[model samples]
Target chain A: MLQKRIIVCLDVRDGKTTKGVKFKGNVDIGDPVLMAEEYYKQGVDELVFYDITASSEKRGIMIDIVKKVAEKIFIPFSVGGGIRTLSDMKQVILAGAEKVSVNSSAVKNPSIISEGAKHFGKQCIVVGMDVEMDFSKPSGYGIVINGGRTKVDLDALEWAKKIEKLGAGEIVLNSIDADGTKNGYEIKLTRMISESVGIPVVASGGAGTSMHLADVFNEGKADAALIASMVHIDGYTVGGIKEFLNKENIPVRI
Target chain B: MKIGILNYDAGNLKSVETALAHLGAKYFVSSDPYELAKSDKLIFPGVGEAQSSMKILKKRGLDIFLREYFKKGNPILGICLGCQIVLDSSEERNTKCVGLVPGNSKEFSHNMDLKIPHMGWNQVQSTNNHYIFKDIPNNSSFYFVHSYYPDPDNQNAVIALTDYGISFSSAFSVDNLVAVQFHPEKSGPHGLKLLDNFISKTQGV
Candidate 1:
């Protein structure tokens, strides 16, 4: 059976890993490459590096950072934020990243997902959606972009189906409300998207403990769990989390 | 020993290059059959669609070169789709592969109650002693992300197995042909150790 994945996200800005409270008022934490190496050494299943300012700054991805991390760690590493075109995807992939994640850019063009997927193959194209619970939207969650500052007409769940239909291989459903709260994942919302889409759904935000990771995999039916605050600042290690999850009868890559 | 890697505009080139560089090994990345043939060993590291990759290999004349090279008992290792391409055919786009083996690459059945692309780290168990698993512990987790796996005509060729709702050949070694569905370039420490084993075997060849 496919073991549940535990991914550590490195929010990078200007080559340094930064942590923001709900995507706002961030602070520099550590070096991106060093932190990635440490996490890799700690046995994290995968790594996601989001150039937090790349989309907002309207620039190409930071290829140097990606290369540095890729050289140090040998695992499935995905890069997102500010990826706008096929060339960007190619450059990132060629720099040693396994997958190129598209968030704000996918919403702005929509064709980026299809085009990127077509060019790089769907396995390399990951659609990262930042969602906020909103009754007005069709799926009860509104699509937010630009680090959750902009709202789009697309409903979260509907847009997820569209992204999958557009050939995106995987989805990172980040619950804006659960993000940075340290409470728990939005299990109900995650279950909805996980059940609806055929691709692997990575439930992000509000992962406070190993139990949260277990909940996302078992109850939420999520294929993977993306954690930030817990592992980032709460003194939780990837090894500790996996050990805890494995003890709880959860199938982890430990 | 020299390592020649086939690069057909695939994404695994740089990563494999990095891993080799870390091992302090001399290697070259090229598509020219002549240049790759000069090396002591070869690696066909790849990540992309089967159809386009085969088309590119054909245009570069490496497809014919590789089929003959491996058939002659030359040392070559194929990773992920690279391993799949060594097979006779692939379900992906119904493309004909290089056919290093008699089997075809099969798509994970949709009704298997499993994920299409089994993306993550899982334990791989080697059934017999092989050079690739030398000094590596059994049931070690390696990073794997793929939908299709090779169904080799010769079951004896399979040296390692991993289960993902179904048991398949995670890796196989036949004569001089070696291939793995898992990306050894991205499987962390154990992967590095496995690569070291391959490099050591090619030391005096």
Candidate 2:
């Protein structure tokens, strides 16, 4: 059976790992390399490093961190944020990251997704969608970009389908409404995107407890859950979460 | 001690190289058949489409080199697409592969509810006590990212099986050649352990 993955997402700013609430008020937590190694030791299924300060000025720094993290952690990890060009994608992959995710840039120049997928196999390309609830949109969720600050006219479900067709092997569907809230995952939104896309959908944001993780997997139909505060601040270990999910009869790597 | 990572313009070989470096093993990445042939062991790591990969491998004469190298009985480890191409053929684009092993690579059926690419960690049940699986627990999950799987013509060639809507060979050993449908390099600690076993244990089967 294919186990549902529990991925730890680290938001990196400058060189330190930071966590912000609803993409605001971020505070430095720890070194991403060390934290990544610790979580890798604790048996996190995968790790995602998002360069929160995703600007052209900070790309060199992110690449350096990515190289350091790659050397220490053997598990699969994805690097996102500020990845706008094919050259950026190549630099990250050469730095040893398995997958390179493009979010806002993907929305701006949708061709970047197809270009990245063509240059590197689709498996190497991940489309990180930051979606917010908007009943006016056809899917009732509108695409938000620029770190959830700007709302776009695109529909979430339609965009997901387009990216899949554009050769995005995986979709990291992060609900802006549920992000950093700890209220629980937006199951309705997640299920809609997960069911609509043939590719694997990783439910990101709003993971408060192990139950929430289980709920996202079961009710939300999420293939994987991207967690932050639960493990980063709430003192939940990856192994402990996996054990709880195991008890819940959800297939997890144990 | 020299580990040559065969690079036939397949995909990113950085992860494989980084993993080997972390293992403190001296290695080189090369597409040149002569350079790769000189290594004591060869690690064939690949990603991307089989048809295009075959084109590059043929252009560089890596296909012939790999077959000859396998015939020599030198220890070779194949990962993901590397594992698939070792088979006789692949249902992916109706492509033919290097016939070192006795099977064909078949695509996972979309008719089933599961995703086409069986991506993620899945348990691999060891069918044979092959040395490649030494110290690795039975039913331990390894990271996988692929649409097609190696389907050996001979059941005996299969040393491990995994189920994802169907039972398929996740790992197989035929004499000195060992291949896995999963990426052990990216599979965390146990994955590193498998790579260690492949590198340290000179003999296979």
Candidate 3:
């Protein structure tokens, strides 16, 4: 049986692992390599490095950080944000990222996803969707881009299905409204997207406690859960979370 | 002494490098036939279309060089796409391969819940207890990402088997040439142990 993944997310800026509330009010955490190694030692299944920076500054710093982390950690690492082209995906993968997650760039040019999947294999491409519930819209939730600052009219579920068709190996359903809330994952939203897509779904955002993770796995039926705030603040170690989940009979890497 | 990783413009070489480094083994990335031939051991790692990779290998004369080097009993390990290339042929693009191993690769068409390109980690059921799996726990899972798998004609060539809609040859060893369908480099400690075993076994070969 496939085990559920416990992923630790690092919001990197200028080569540092920084964290913020709801994608604003950022605070410098530390060097990405150091943080990545720390998470690896704690037995995190995977690591996600989101380069929360402008497009121009993203390439060099992201590559440098990937090289640094890849040097210290042997676990699967994913780099996202400002990944615009196939060359960008190749650069990161060559630099040592096992998977490249694209959001805004993939949306603007959806063919990039198919081209990337064709070139690097589908497992190498990850589509990160930043979604929020829009009561005004018919589907309730709308897809957002540019660090969740702009809401596109496209329905979140519709976009997910389209990207899956476009050859995205996995979908990271990140709830913008639930991000940094630390209450729990947006169960309904995550579940909706997970059920809608045939591929693996990684639930991101608003993971607070062990129960929250259990809820995501049990209710959302997610293959993996991406946690940042709780782990970064020492609220829960990766091992602790896994142990907790394991006690609950949830299959997690231990 | 650095291990030479054949850079065939295919597969995830950096991950292989990281796995080797974790085992405290020094390695260098190279596609130069001379550089590869002189190394202690060679890792023919790849991940791409079979025809294109075979084209690159032939254009660089690596195909001939690898065959010659293997005849000398040099230890060479192939991973994923690398493993497929060792076979006689591949269904991917209907391309002929290095033919180092007595097998042919084919695509999966089995009606199963799993998708094509079997991604994520899976366990290997060892066949005959080889040195490569020494100290590695049984039913240990390793990361796998591929669409096609090798079907070896010789059953003895198989070292392990894994089920993905169907049981397939997960690992094979014939003399100095060994290959794995899974990426041991991407796998964790278990994978590093396999690399370490290869290094120790091939150190003086």
Candidate 4:
């Protein structure tokens, strides 16, 4: 039995850790290196660093932060946000990110996924999808990009399948509506995407409690759960989630 | 003593280096035949297509060197693709392997319910108590991320088995050569312990 993974997401901006509610109302959290070390101590299975800064000046500085975090943390680290080209992906990978994720760039130029996969291997390319419920659409969920500010008008499930075909090793399915809500995971949306794709699906957003993690694993059938606020706010430790899942007979690293 | 890590231009070398450092073992990342032969032990770690990796090995003449080294009973450990390459051949690209183990690697087609790659932590059932898992607890979880696995025909070659879609060899040992499908570097404390065990065995501790 494969153990379920608990990943802590650190949204980095201007060389500092920050978090936003539903991709809005950004708030400063702390230093990325410090936050990453803390999460590593708390037994996080993996760490995700998403660079949210909107300035070109901060791009190089962000890679420096990734280098700092990767130097100390032994677990797998993934870096995303503003990764537009193969050079950008290579820089991050060279900076010590086990995987590099592309969102807007992969959507605009789908070949970037194939290119990155070719250069760094498919296992290192992660496709991030921000999805929202659209009542007019038959699939009900539409793809959102550009930090969840723009709608692509494509079905989220369809896009996930397409990216997998494009050679994305894994899919990080983030629910825009469920982001920062702390209610629970969007089971239907996650399940649809997970079932539609053959690769691994990581469910992100709305993980408020330990039960929420279990709910996503049980209902969504997600390979892993990505939590930012819950762990950031000290609502639950990664070890705590693993313990809870272990008690519930779910395989998780403790 | 510097442990030689086979640099075939693939896989997680840094994480493996970190794990070795945590175990307080000094190692060198090398592909040079002389450096590899001079090292105390060799670690062949990889994380990609077998055909591509074998191509690089052959291009560099590492294939002949590794085959000769294993025959001398020099300690060698292969992780994931590294482990698969020790077999007679792989279904991947229909390529021939080092043939150190009496088997061939094949893709898991028996179970569709279980996902391919078998990524994440899974427990291993030891076939026989070897020094490699001395301090590691039984039923301990180790990180694994691979699609195809080697099915060794010799029962003595298998030292551990892990249940995924089916019971498969997770670790195998035949004299000085040992290999595992899991990544001990990424598997937390248990992983560190496994590394410690390997180092202790290498040092004759």
Each prediction's interface RMSD?
1.4, 0.8, 2.0, 1.8
Residue A217, candidate 4: C-alpha displacement in angstroms: 1.3
Q: Give the runs in model 3 whose Cα sits over 4 Å from its true position.
A: A54-59, A135-139, B22-26, B202-205
State in Å the error of residue A246, model 4: 2.4
Q: Residue by residue across A154-220, what tens digits does model 3's lDDT show?
A: 8888899999899888999999999988888999988888877768889998988899999999999
- Top-scoring candidate (TM-score): 2
TM-score of chain B of each: 0.96, 0.97, 0.95, 0.95
Worst 10 residues of 2 chain A by lDDT: A52-61
Candidate 1 residue runs with Cα over 4 Å from true position:
A54-61, B202-205
Model 4 agreement with the true structure over B1-205: per-residue lDDT tens digits: 6689999998658778867876789899988887788888889998889898889998988999898888877688888899999898999989898888889888987347766667777888877888888878888878788888878889788999998888899999887888999988777777778777777674433
Q: How should the candidates be ordered by lDDT, best one leading?
A: 2, 1, 3, 4
Give the TM-score of candidate 2 (chain A). 0.98
* Candidate 3 chain B minimal-lDDT segment of 10 residues: B110-119
lDDT of 3 by residue, B60-142 (tens): 99999889888888788888999888989999889999998778998977456565567667778888998889999888887
User: What TM-scores result for chain A when each predicted structure is judged separately against the true chain A?
Assistant: 0.96, 0.98, 0.97, 0.98
Per-residue lDDT of model 2, residues A1-254, tens digit only: 99999999999999889999998899999999999989998899899999987566866888999999989998899999888899999999999999999999999999999999899999999999999999999889999999999988999999999999999999999999999889899999999999988899999989999999999999999999999999889999999999999999999988
What TM-score goes with each of the models? 0.96, 0.98, 0.92, 0.95
**Of the candidates numbered 1 and 2, which has the greater lDDT value?**
2
The superposed Cα distance between candidate 1 and the true structure at residue A157, in angstroms, equals: 1.3
